[model samples]
Target chain A: MSSCKFINTPALLLDLEIVQRNARLMLDRCQKLGVQLRPHMKTHKTLECADIMTGGSRRCIVVSTLAEASFYADRGYDDILYAYPLPFDKVERCAQLSERLSLFHVLLDNSLALQQLKKRPLSHGKIWHTAGVELTGIYAHCGNTYGCKGEEQIKAVAQQTTAITLQFMEKLKAIGIQGPKSSIGSTPSCSHPVPEMAMLSEVHPGNYVFYDVQQSLIGSCKLEDVAVRVLTRVIGHYPHRNQLLVDCGWTALSLDGGGRLPTGYAIIEGHPELKLTSMTQEHGRVEPISGELDFSQFPLGSVLTFIPHHACATAAMHPVYYVHSKGKIVDTWKPTRGW
Target chain B: MSSCKFINTPALLLDLEIVQRNARLMLDRCQKLGVQLRPHMKTHKTLECADIMTGGSRRCIVVSTLAEASFYADRGYDDILYAYPLPFDKVERCAQLSERLSLFHVLLDNSLALQQLKKRPLSHGKIWHTAGVELTGIYAHCGNTYGCKGEEQIKAVAQQTTAITLQFMEKLKAIGIQGPKSSIGSTPSCSHPVPEMAMLSEVHPGNYVFYDVQQSLIGSCKLEDVAVRVLTRVIGHYPHRNQLLVDCGWTALSLDGGGRLPTGYAIIEGHPELKLTSMTQEHGRVEPISGELDFSQFPLGSVLTFIPHHACATAAMHPVYYVHSKGKIVDTWKPTRGW
Candidate 1:
């Protein structure tokens, strides 16, 4: 049983408690809003986190890729929604999964995509469409909410998205169509749902389970709610350059944020003055945001925790998550990769 | 026997012929220069590429991570040099490899790192240090050459780096030290080596095996020499935004080069007018650089090949590389991941 301190450098450290709390809160939020929470698994595609997000039932999930859908399905988890617009090359795989899973659903996308789905109808009584098209639901990702700065802006975006979604549903009702579910998602909007969101059938928001600095900046979570950190070890001290080289790089921390943060790509957990200025494949250049870097503070082999800017992007870089609680590594979770 | 056309989208497709040509050229260049070519394995960490790179010698390679060192060591590869500065946390693992392999080298780094290596003395007649230190070789990565634009600039930087390395080697000799080797490496510098580079003992260039748009811009190789491309499919067309959505995203292509190229993040192979403007986790937004994006020209599900901006960064995002020749998939190579 290795502890967090003893783990290798450039490892993703998942706080088990923060993850569970984040998971529980989302479940509670959707429960209170009288809507189903079909958590998205794109952020951390590990079975353990999926179980946490789904509250162990492993039911009602959304995946970004068929690889994740198959990974979950192979493990007996069902009721999945392939959330993206239908990809034609993957239609056959989608059909196979649809026939295998209890409720494997894909988006009712453009007419061309509809043809791909119709070419391979479900044989196991899992009917998602009929008469060349089927209206399961309308899905809209409130991705603009990611630009929000605070809770008020987030709620405003959520309210707008929900109202428009409801108006669209009303239009569908006018055309003799009804009972189709509506889903609007983005971690920011879902984390601070508007009151009108209760009218939707389900809410799907990933990244909340592993809230990060981006979610914090978007007002989706407090800084403390971030559950994951890239644990890196200082390898060199360059006093002349006023920089420190750490073991984490784009391969471990990702270049998603574009190093735009005030603290650079990620926020140093305890060092406010330090910024992760840039990275190569396996080396990160850390320097102070203001004054000269005190090289003694970051001795060689000293660990520094990084709260990632985007959890999904950083999580994808790591092959395994070191899940820990109270500084003790409790478990290791492997994630499925590739589509 | 799947072909490139039938394989799944958002895959790394390696051109076997190009790769072989690249390996052969690098080997020939080093042989002509009278220097050992210890190709770095960070670009594509697959054994197949390693075999092609070393000409099946299975020895004298450089890796950025211990996982890579162990991965190669387990497969009977020897003379492994963990090219990174000695990381404190990985010292124990390094020691084990040091005692196990014929030549497992770590950087003779700062005094603190020297102490870490001193803590674990090598046994069984293997020696890296005695009396608190040993000088195996001097290694310098001429990474500054990555910014060079053409052959002249690359040769200039290569000459400068070689001169500085030789000067340092002379300083070591002045201090009564002899029989120490020197190495300076970068794809651009090694691709167009200066005459003085022949004085160095070794050159380790990795990304030359998978040249990319960045390397082409740096003038290391012709764009046609790039051996890998990310195969993506257009999944959606938003004619309103004049954009096409491809299944390739940051997850497949990586957020490297920061969309700095005229073609945004990457150069769409044979589609010079297009730019990969942006990407989410699983979606890439492609739009024309100047004119309207005639949607009919790119039907839904049509494939687009993308030459990555940075091959090492993009390759790190993928789990497997699909090797092909003349449009037929010949083999698949799985690369080791994690630190």
Candidate 2:
């Protein structure tokens, strides 16, 4: 902290070491399993994290928004997949990206979207192959993995998703479609990858880059592996209400988990006794889980770090992430926002 | 829509006429009440909306964040009140602002905050005059008005808050403090203001510029007064699941109001029968509140307008708001985000 300048409260802090470790482990796991790791950029949309997650390849990334795709493509990254279903209004933008980039992909779950794509033809010798729709990949998000409890349940869901996806791919092959990739995603599934998943073409998981309390609870990562935190300071101590009001609120941490966590909205880092009971626009009310809150232990000016319930949701609330390592602020990463 | 170019989907659309009407009504109300309407910028942190709310006067405004204070201050706005309890981390910044601006106010609810403020002496001769902590005004938020169900409840809460605030001000005068000023705010209380509120020096009510479903439900304003909406397009039709996927998600509209509305997270404009049931990263699952959803009626690629649950929360999610009037694109307003 001595090396770092004055940091504004309610700031998003990213631990570089934890992030790098998370990224390296995921990349190594994917490489050993013989599956392409096209990491999703929805969680930490910053380029620094993307570079670490991609192992500096800067290719084969999945983005939830066109803004991210354009942002990455503008900075020498290619082979971007706008993983969302084809937004009809953005068809022209998609066509432009497909023409400009070496391999930009758009997805369609129905024939109407295919027709919408067909309405606009791509130049540069690109054609809508495979029955007027390029069967680039079959993407399935195993979102149900979020409901899992432990390693056994996570593995079970992962295996089930893999089996179902493989069966779908077999059906595609039976219909004489070949060479299209098959990818299934969700941080919980990818973190504890099943042996059967190795047969799939790729796996996309974004939240592992900055795992939060939600993922830790779902067996995706340990609590220590979660890299990001909202650094807030106590602003008020109300003994009558048995609460300590903090500067961090939904504006900083977001309301993603619906305050369902045992620790409420988020886990107060290193203080398992504290629970973030509720938040307004710019103020979070924190109270103890069981016993009385000793106000002296948490002086008004003292800082409290909160590990968020969902990293992706929390990260979206921040404009810039302060990267720190060895108790020193190293860098700042600005994430591209909006569609 | 014909006058505009291909507008982006999942876009925040601000009805310019409605905004102007809302602003004018609030301004007239405050003028008639004989109190200064110092609008809070937390709802729409944009220069355009600020100007409209202030009747083109950038002076006399309240903000929820320091970033907003700096943003407005940089653009020649004066008489700013950072209406948050002084955080220890921001004392120096507050001092600097006080020195730079003609009038910059910071609040304190505790003695420690006053000590922190005293430490940061402003370069300008701005003194901490009143017993070591300046009583700029007695500011209280009638947040309880949010729980009200109709105008009767709204007015009752407003009157009670006004009575309490006036009593506090009377106590201050009795203690020999003469000219500090008094103010209480919140959209609900300020909208249906009590006559006693006229005795106050100023009133700060934001969110009227773009009232949302929550405020309407709270009887602050009618649903027709909501001037902002998220413009999304139906992308997928899942008859088997009885759902239609829209391109808007929590990333666009935010997960506020806890999806407690009968229409779920947001009200589908002109389609009260439809409900925005749930959302993922980049998709919203739309299902009817009851009965089978007619698939053909909402064909893929058709645009859908969603009146948000909370305008402040939804407006914060957008990078830029598309302002429209008379079915034509009039202007765009980019809001300042993050603290």
Highest lDDT against the true fold, candidate: 1
- Which TM-score values does chain B get in all models? 0.97, 0.97
Q: Residues A1-339, candidate 2: write the lDDT tens digits.
A: 443336888999999999999999999999999999999999988899899999999999999998999999999999898888788888888888888888888888888788888889889887643233678778899999999998899999999999999998899899998888889978999998988999999999999989999898899989999999899989999999999999998999999999998999999988999999999999999999998999999998888999999899999999999999999999999999998
Q: What share of the true interface contacts does each candidate keep?
A: 0.94, 0.81
Residues A234-304, model 1: lDDT tens digits = 99888889999999999999998899999999999889998999999999999999988778788889999
lDDT of 2 by residue, B57-110 (tens): 889999999899999999989999998888888877788888888888888888
Give RMSD to native, each candidate. 1.6, 1.6
| lDDT over C-alpha atoms for residue B313 of model 1 | 91
lDDT for each candidate structure? 0.90, 0.89
- Alpha-carbon deviation at B303 in model 1, angstroms: 0.6
Any runs in candidate 1 off by more than 4 Å, and if so which? A129-133, B129-132
TM-score of each: 0.98, 0.98
- When summed lDDT is taken over every stretch of 10 residues in candidate 1 chain B, the lowest stretch is B125-134
